[model samples]
Structure formats: structure tokens, C-alpha cells
Target: MMFHYYAVLAIAALSCSSTRFGVVNAQIVGQFSLEFTAVFKPAGIAQKLFTELSDPETSILQGSILSTSGLIYDPNNVAIKEVAGQFAGGVQPFLNPPDISADGTIDGQCTATSVNEEEGKILAHSCFFNICAIEADDCINFYSGSPFVYAPALDQNQLPPSYPGTIIGGTGVFEGIEGSVEVITVAGREFTSQTSSSGDIAQRIFLNTNFEFLERRKI
Candidate 1:
């Protein structure tokens, strides 16, 4: 069965000077959106880890990991635009020319901390995305709070629900940046085995007038 997920996340940033938590008043807000396909296919436990529970009723226990890597795209293209139309929210495809990529790569990592079998959801911790520009060496990083709900797919053709995240900081051109981000899982698949899982995802990044960006060095 092929699982799919559709996300329309918004990410925005404000340039800052301090590390972790310092705010500078700059009137300029950097905003943009990028689309990407995410795949979760880990080769082994070293890259992906799962904790098995004795409860046979439990499909997913606490302390499982979600890791994936894929390509980033500029949503302005016709191919992605057509795909966006198939989702629920009649979301328009767009591209922010200055900071992000026309096409690039993305890597994500998140770990489950709590499980809700009754609701079919898991609370994940330290979720983040590292997106890089194609051909360029610069990459921007976005992170989630200590915990966020990881919703499961509704059917055999969809992925878990998308969640909110923050732009902690970045490297090279994206250094000392701050912003708000909404990650849309445009497409994805559940990792159901000891070997691998796969999916496709898209992200829309925009700046928030009320908040400031957090700074952290690239990993």
C-alpha cells in the first residue's frame, strides 16, 4: 500500500544577532515557501530505532524514530502545482525567489516520546528539518518544541498529519535567523518495518510579525 500526505506549511523569518535567544528589532521580514519530497527509508537501527512493547495490541510504542531525506522544490513549477490541487485546501503554489531554492534537498529527524493508542497518535520530541539549496552549500534549520502530536494516516494512501515548527537558526547565508514555520506533509509513508519507509513533503515558510527567530548553529 502506498501512503500519501499533503501539507501546506508556512515559514517566516526575522534576522537576529544573538545565539539561542536574543531579539533585534529589524523592520525587514524574510518570507518564502519551498516544496519538497520526503522519504523515510532507513537502512538499519543505527539510522532508525524502534522500541518494541510487550503489548501485542500496540502498533507503535514510545521511543520510535522518524528519519527521512529527500529533494526540495520551488512550488512555482507546473508539476507541483498540479499535485497541490489534489489536496483538500485549494492551496496555491508559490515561490519566494531570494532565500530558498528552486530545487534542493531536505533531511528530517524526530523521535516519539509518548504514545496514545486509543487515539492512534504519538507525541514526538525534537522534530526538525534541515533544508539545503541545490548546488549551494547553505542550509537553513527548523525545529519543533519539546513535544508535538504525530498523527497517523487516515488511509493506505496518506501520511500522518502535519505539525507546527520553528526556525531555530541556520548556517552560511541563513545564519542568526529567526522565524515561524508551518510544515505541510504533502506526501509520506509510514515506516512499518525494520528496514525502511518513504514519503513526499512540502513546506511553506513565512515571517511572523509578532515573533523573533531563535539562533542555533548548523549540525
Candidate 2:
């Protein structure tokens, strides 16, 4: 009975101490930047047909998957290579009548490795002129877990020809760390025909990015 009483008291004390420690440790915040380039090479393509509306309505949907490979360069001169598989689908909605403007949304995901073999998924609500973003931008977030766990609060966008992106938060080794990036893109839509390679109707983009990182003072 005496031993049982002491054990119960000891366990309660430890639990209270742990709770207090957690409360004392505050989360950190910061911002930084990085840079690199990602090349998305189309591997296959597919067109989604709307049977009910056989006659041209006001939009068309097309999608494809690409083997993405790239290297990310940081402001501190760190090189991070990424080999990823990305799949995306988008619909080119027509204007009031039937004007095909490059205003649409593309949503997809990519699996790559940097700090670890993490498959980061993203849904970018963006606009583009053919394969290039013209005077528009997008915001995307990424989460990585496996060897290490982290989240790159993403902002992938383009201001006309080039743009900037940033990371707002993270976890584990990347906890309290934030980063930023600059982007310059070269798309196949400008270089190659709209449809090519055995009528696959492919599209590719070379995304060049630069980054920098900073750790917060707390946590």
C-alpha cells in the first residue's frame, strides 16, 4: 500500500512537470529564401471529353503527367537535387462567347527528395498564357515526412515573366524556419508547337528558383 501511494504521487509529479515544460517552450517564427530550377518533361497526356455537351460549349479540359527533375540552390550555396513525378490537370474555359484566353487553373502534386524522400502535394489555383504565367500568380503549400518531417508553406507564383515564392512555417529539423525563392520560367508552349510528339499534345516548363533560409529566435 505504501509503495503504491508513492508511485502514484511520483507519476503525477512527472506529468505535471512535463505539461509545464511544454507550456514554457514557445514556437518560433522566421523568413528566408532559396533558388533552383525544376524541369517538367511530359511523359504522357490525356484529354477529358464531355459527352453530354458534344457541341463546343465554352471550355476544354486536358491533363498530363511529367517526370520532373531539378536542383535547388540556396543563398548560402547549398545544392539540393530533386527527382520527382508530377501529375496535373487543367481546363481552359472560354470567355463570354468562345475566346480562348490563357486564364485557367492547374492543380497537381509532385513527389521529390530534398531533406528526405518526401512526396509533397500541391493544388495551385493559377492562371497562365499558354504555358507561361502572364501578370498572374499562385500560392501552394508542401508537406514532407519520412526521414524527417517538415512543411514548406508555399507561394508558387509568377508576376508576368518572373516571380517570387516563400515558405512560412516548418517542423522537426526545419521547425521555425522560413524561406523565400525567386522564379524564372521557360515553357514549351513558347518554344514547341501546341501539340507535338506523336500527337501527345504535350506541355513542359522549366522552373528556375532561388532560395534563402532563416531560423526564428524561439522554439
Against the true structure, whose TM-score is highest? Answer: 1
Which run of 10 residues does model 2 get worst, by summed lDDT? Answer: 15-24
Q: Could you estimate the TM-score for every candidate?
A: 0.54, 0.28
State in Å the error of residue 68, model 2. 5.7
Can you tell me which runs of candidate 2 are displaced by over 4 Å? 1-31, 44-124, 127-160, 164-168, 187-219
lDDT of each: 0.46, 0.24
lDDT string, candidate 1, 1-219, tens digits: 000112222553322221111112222233433223332223411244444457554455466676667654434331323332233232223334334333446677777777775675676666777766555555668887555665543343443556677777766556666666666554433345435433333444332322222332322
TM-score (C-alpha) between model 1 and the true structure: 0.54
> Clash totals for all models, in order?
20, 13
Off by over 4 Å in 1: 1-49, 53-59, 78-102, 150-155, 190-219
Model 2, CA-based lDDT: 0.24
Q: Report the lDDT of model 1 for residue 3.
A: 8
